[model samples]
Target: MSPKILVVLSSHDKLGDTGKQTGWYLPEFAHPYYKLEGKADMTIISPKGGAAPLDPSSVEMFKEDAEASKFLKEKEALWTNTDKLSNYLGKADQYDGIFYVGGHGPMFDLATDSDSQQLIKEFYEAGKVTSAVCHGPAAFVNVKLSDGSYLVKDQEITAFTNTEEDQVGLSSAMPFMLETKLQENGAKIVKADQPWGVKVVQSGKGGKLITGQNPASAAGIGEAILAAL
Candidate 1:
């Protein structure tokens, strides 16, 4: 049987009162979804249960990207009609793994959502794959395992870096710095050599905790997830 993966997206659309619309980054989800499509069956879900917002900037920036464009047109319903994350909380057995696609939005919602945290904990403790990219790792910031240790605790990981956040000039707008929070949670975080460079870290029990540095690492994160699975 094909691996069944649950793809989680952020429901928050507002970008920290910056008056900018933000949601999941297009390429971050787009690239990985396609990479894992034939290999794994996926179900998309979010906190709000519908229309996982797409960051406008990511849409505009990738206007010419064939993969992103194709995904938006062909798989629009997958994102726009996401189911409720809460519905899957105790149903981790249905999925082989869970994946998070990053945008500034996850920093606002998924990071603190109790349901999201619980689901991650269930997956992690069950020895299942748990992965994220860019701001997606924000969801890991507050996910404590059964022993009260943060899920990222003592794990090697990577996410949108503090420098990249500042470079993009939205550091102050975020509720907290993602990379810093992950580090504070005891994750030995690493990053790419340069901003926007592709970097994916797979560490934790059985290397099932996979994370990517930025949008550039989306496909790599998917590849890592497949390897871990």
Candidate 2:
């Protein structure tokens, strides 16, 4: 059977108080979608069940990249009207894995969303291939095991770092630094050698909690998830 993968995206569109638009980053979703296209069956979804917004800056930034550009032209439906995350609360077992795609939007919504927290807990407890990239790990912040421990606790993974957030000049606008929050949750983050470079990390526990550091690492994140699946 082709592995069924659930791709969760953030539905929030406002970027703090900057009057800027932000949601899922284009490459974060695009790169991974193409990588897994023939290998898995993907269902795109979000908290609100439709129109998961894209970060405008990300769209412009990746506009010149052929793969991202192609995705923008060809995959409108995937991000346009998504299935609601709440609809799959009890159906996680149907999926081989769950991927949380990110932008600044995830930091605001998915990070603290109760539904996201519960769903991630279900996937993690079931030993499914749970994964996220960049700010995507924000979704993991509140997922807890039956034992009441954070799923990410003591897990070695990576996400968009504090330095990277600061470099982007939105650190102050963020609720909290992702790296710091993950650390507080007991996640042992593995940093990339340089900023804006590809870096993917497999979780310390049997490599299930795969994560990537930034936009440049999205494709690597996809490759890693495919291998895990």
Candidate 3:
């Protein structure tokens, strides 16, 4: 049987403020969804049960990209009816891996939610690949392993960087910076040329934990996860 993977999305709706443009970027989720959907039995879930928000800017960009445009119009059901994370936490062992999709929104909720932290721990301890991209790595900030250590500590990984955060003008708006926090916790951080550059890092003999720099790296990240599986 093909492996099953759980794709967790951010539930945050506002960006900086309620009226501003911020949420999950369309391409980030679409590219990976396309790559993994058929090859793996994939299930999309969110911190909240329904209606995952889209960053307005991403929606505009998608309108211009044919693939993304098609996804937006045809995958309406996925966006409108995401499974709640709470419902899946009890059944995490059913999946082969867990992937956290990125957006500024994850920084707002994924990092601190107790349920999210627990899910990460459960998946990691079960020997499943636990992967994330961009600010999605923020969710790892508080995930504790069976030994009581942060799951990411001393692991070589990459995420949306501090410099990129400033370039995007979100450095001041985020609850906390991802790169800084990851380093402070003992991760040996690796990065690519620019904030928007596509990059991915995998660590462990089985390549069990994976991370990507940003949305541009989502496809590569998905490939890595599939390979590991």
Candidate 4:
């Protein structure tokens, strides 16, 4: 059977107290979906399992990318009706991997949702590929392995960096610094040369942990997941 991939998104739409709207970044999902579509069966899910909101800026960014536009027009059903994160916590064995699409939103819900934490732990401990891009790595903040150690402990990873967060002007608005939290949890973090640079990390052959630096790393991370699978 083709590998089954679970794509997780954040249902939260508010961007801190800034009063701005946010959710999953469109191309982060669109780029990866298109790249993984034929190779794997993907199910998009959120904490509440309804229409996952799109970051307004990402929607605008989609206009310049043909792949993202194609996904928007043709793949609405997948993202519109997602499964509940609660429904897959114990049953994650059905999925060969999980991919988290980033946006300012994940920093709110996915970062601290108990169910999301449990699910990430399940996938990681099961030796299944666990991939996240940009703020998607927010989901890793509180995940603990079966042995009670952080899943990211001693792992080399990357996410939306502190500098990039400040560059995007959301530094003060986030609940916490994503890169700092990952570092606190013992991740040997590496960053790219600049804000939008692509940085995809795949541990080793058949390695289960995969992460991308920012939006620019989405497609590259998707390809890494395929190879890991």
Candidate 5:
């Protein structure tokens, strides 16, 4: 049987108070999805279970990329029919890996979700590869490992950087910055020079923990998770 991988997405709806643009980006989820689809039985899940938002800006970024554009159009059903995190937490062991795709949405909802934290801890302790990209790593802040420490503690990982956040003008809107919090939790964070650069970091000899720098690295992140599996 093919390995099953849980792809966690955020259900956050608002980008900022203006509500101008918000949602998961096409490349962030679609690029990884296509890469993993052939290798694993992929399951997409979300915090609230249905209709995850998509950041409007993401659509513009991939407007010229055909594969990304196609995937974005077909993703409506998947987004609208996603399973709630609670539903998957009960059967966390059924999967071989867990991947979190990101946009600005994750910093708001995925960070504080108790179910998300529990599911991440369970999958990690069960020896499944745990991976995330961009702002997706924000969810790791609250995940407590079996050893009573943060899962990211002492782990080498990467995520959306403060510089990128500032460039996007979302620094003040975020509940907390990912890079600072990950470092505070003991992660050795590595980031790319630019947010759109492709960068993936696997912290530990076994490559058990993985994180990608931004949307451009989603394919690399997916490949890394597949390799670890």
Candidate 6:
């Protein structure tokens, strides 16, 4: 069987109280989708189901990238047909792995959704390739493993760093810094020297959890996940 990969996206469109719009970052999803589409069967899911919103700035930023353009033009159905996270909470065994795509949106919903938390834990316990990129790791902030330990505890992982969050100017609006929360959860954070530089980490525990630092690391994360599979 071609491995089935579940791609979870954030459904929250508003970025905290900033009155700014945000959702799944286009390149974060587009880059990985292009990388894994032919090699795996991918399913899209979100908190509310239906069409997940797009981060407007990301759409404009990658407007000219050929792969992104192709994805925008050809994958409209995937955007409209997402399954609700609730629908798959106990079905993690059906998937070979889970990929969380990030934008500012994940910070609002995926970080706290109990269903998403449970699904992530299930995937982790199954010894599957569980992965996330950028703010996508927000989903990992509260996940507890079967042994009642925080999944990220002592794991070598990377996500949108505090410096990158400040550079983006969303720090004040966000509930808390992602890197800090991950650290509080006991993850040993790793980061790239420069913002937008590529950084991907395989969890200290036998490389089951794969993470990427930022949007620029999306394609690399996809490659790593495929290799893990």
The local distance difference test score of model 6 is: 0.91
lDDT of 4 by residue, 1-229 (tens): 8999999999999999998899999889988887888899988899999898889888887788898888888888877899898999887789899999999999999988999999988888788999999999999978888899987888888899999999888899999999999999999998888777989987622667899999899899988888888
Candidate 2 vs 6: which has more TM-score: 2
Report the C-alpha displacement of residue 105, candidate 4, in angstroms: 0.8
Global lDDT of each model?
0.93, 0.91, 0.85, 0.89, 0.85, 0.91
Clashes of 1: 0
Give the per-residue lDDT digits (tens) of candidate 3, residues 99-124: 98888988898989899899988888
- Model 4 residue 152 lDDT? 82
Q: Which runs in model 5 stand beyond 4 Å of their true positions? A: 193-195
Residue-wise C-alpha lDDT for candidate 5, range 25-76, written one tens digit per residue: 6788888887877789888899998778888788887899877888878767
Clash count per candidate: 0, 0, 0, 0, 5, 0
Runs of candidate 3 exceeding 4 Å displacement = none
> Using lDDT as the measure, what is the rank order of every candidate, best first?
1, 2, 6, 4, 3, 5
lDDT of 2 by residue, 1-229 (tens): 8999999999999989988889999999999999999999999989998899999999899999899999999999999999999999978788899999989999999999999899988888788889999999999977888999988898987899988998999998898899999999999988889987789988745688899999999999999999999
Error of 3 at 173 (Å): 0.8
Candidate 2: deviation at residue 162, Å? 0.9
Best of the two (2, 4) by lDDT: 2
Clashing pairs in 4: none
lDDT leader:
1
Instruction: Give stretches of model 1 more than 4 Å off.
Output: none
